[model samples]
Target: MSHDNKTAAYFGARDLPDVIDYVGEFGAELVTFLPFVYWLYRAGQLGDRKVSTYRGMRPLYFFLSDDQLIEKDEPRRFVGYQKRTDPSIWGFIPNPNELIATRNAYEAFPNYRKQFQSTRFSFDKPLLVVHNKFNREWNSDTPVNFFSIDQLEQMFSRLKGYYQIVYLRHGRSGSVDGYSPDHNSLIDFDETSVMQRHPEVIDFEQHHREYGGGVAINQYKNELYAACHHFISVQGGGAHQCALFSGSLLLILHKRGPEAVHAYSNGFYQYATNPAPVCMIAFNDRQLQDGLGAFTDASLCQGRVMLGANGSRIANDLAPSRVQRKGQPVFGTDRTPEPGDVGVHF
Candidate 1:
């Protein structure tokens, strides 16, 4: 059988294009398909089998290549897949039953954290990687799932003292191949004023422009992320990328999307990292503020590291709660909790 046929057999399907079409969204690929592919490669089921992916995503597949699963680096193609609307097609399999059973199974796979880790970008203080993007989604007039200028300022003010902040906002020119067209159109923001107001926060794009040394941008980002341990990112590919690194705290400001069910209920973010980073999902500005406050307070009160039940160093005072349990709230209160409450999954 041909490679395509073999892949179909392995996946228990016959149509490669249909599978690809079904798993069309960029985030879905990262959260599901890529991990499944990595799992297969690690299981020694795909010896010397080549995989094809979009150009900027090669760094994500580096673990497979480095492990000699593929004889040569996988072919990187341009992105032009069909758009998928149904959230049921969000995992490795198109069948929801199989997806439910196997959605979180990738957590058991080998950690991709250690494979791409680097210490080249160490800083004087603990690194705080902040990624934001302004783009239209769901035909909205303004961008959804983005940090406003006010929000960015608030976050910088709250966390700058404790961290060497690195701000990343790759506008139109930096949009990757597989991302939706809506993601490519840049919404206007006063990034200049934000940077000027917060001189302490490093503009990652400027730093990359000066020091990237003609390296592939994705690879450069992977190296930078590998060295850092804390991240605050808006929802999208950037948040997913930050979650790939182990032993970190990722606070994602996500207002609405199909990702909510997966990230919160299914515990998908836990498998994104090996030991699993402290993943916090903030649904709105208020929740984001509260989550940041919790971290800042933890930082000031107990220093940087506190031991978890697993003996891993986690944020002090932020006790591990059953936030991933469906219908549970992260922060308990007297009255009924409003929608979009913060949810933190260890």
Candidate 2:
């Protein structure tokens, strides 16, 4: 820590989502004349001080929006990353007790809650995204975050003509209620199958190049999400990222109750500062059954959709009334409502 004047000390790494969160902090730095700001880079994702690695940091400086960077000094540093605690510039850190967290560490940062998105990736076809997150066998303590392949297929069948059900493949696997994503089956996405590509799916690198490049992978990922019309996923990281960056309507399924979700501060707005519309579907009992709950502010309830598990109508039936109210569309009426595709905060 004593010798190198060039290398800056970045705190968070290992987790890709959190790392991207740190990258978002760079925006606050760019707008201000703070001389120099600490750049966060994961352990192997950077280079030695002697060698200025242009490739890794190039995309960031190139693609960042005017609002993303806080007015600060201009110097690139490759600080190391770790997985213990995340600290935002303004100090809005997460409660140490929760095991799973999003950009909560960067919550206090100025641009921390803002969504950095690009529209170049959106398709002309109606888009629907499914971000499945199931717990691995060893990690069964948490509830399942994925849907059965058959369930997904059913969803596709209903939405095929109206919407393209896009499945996200991060080369992951897990089980739920004796069911898991199948490698042999054409529908599942595993490490091996991930390489085999699909016509309907959107891959990050390929799409980025199509849009004229010059951006980091995380920025590209946000671009991919930004292009979509709606996102449906269990309550987890994918849902969190989608809410923050994708600009898609969120349709989330959460198993945890209001008490636990409240205690953990799992609202989507805590992470996504975007003033976009949001609506969450809770699967817990004893909650308000038919009423709606808005994330961020209650007045921004135009497209505010919320329904309890037991007595609520299916998302489709409620879309018209839930998504639009008093002649106003939540995020505009450019896209149609695909139930199971809603929004979140936290």
lDDT of each: 0.57, 0.36
CA RMSD of all predictions: 8.0, 14.5
Count of backbone clashes for each model?
0, 29
Clashing pairs in 1: none
Q: Per-residue lDDT of 1-346 in model 2, one digit per residue for the tens?
A: 3211111223332222222222222222222101112222122332222111122333334324433333222322312122213343211123221222344332232232234445655555655666664443211344344555544554454454555555664434332111122222223334324324334554433454466456555555555555553666664445545554323345555553121223123433333334432444544221112212211112112322333432134333323222221222122221322323332321
**Candidate 1 at residue 266, lDDT?**
47
lDDT of 1 by residue, 1-346 (tens): 5432343465432232322322243454565566666665565554555554444565667765543322222332222222122223432232222112234433233355566566667778877889998866554567777888899889889889988999988752353432223224567766778778999998876777688777667677778887777788887767877766776777778775434544533445655555567666676687677667644633311222233343222232233243433564322121222335435454
What global local distance difference test value does model 2 have?
Answer: 0.36
List ranges where model 1 is wrong by over 4 Å.
1-23, 64-110, 172-184, 298-346
Given candidate 2, what's the lDDT at residue 132?
Answer: 67
Please tell me which predicted candidate would have the highest TM-score against the true structure.
1
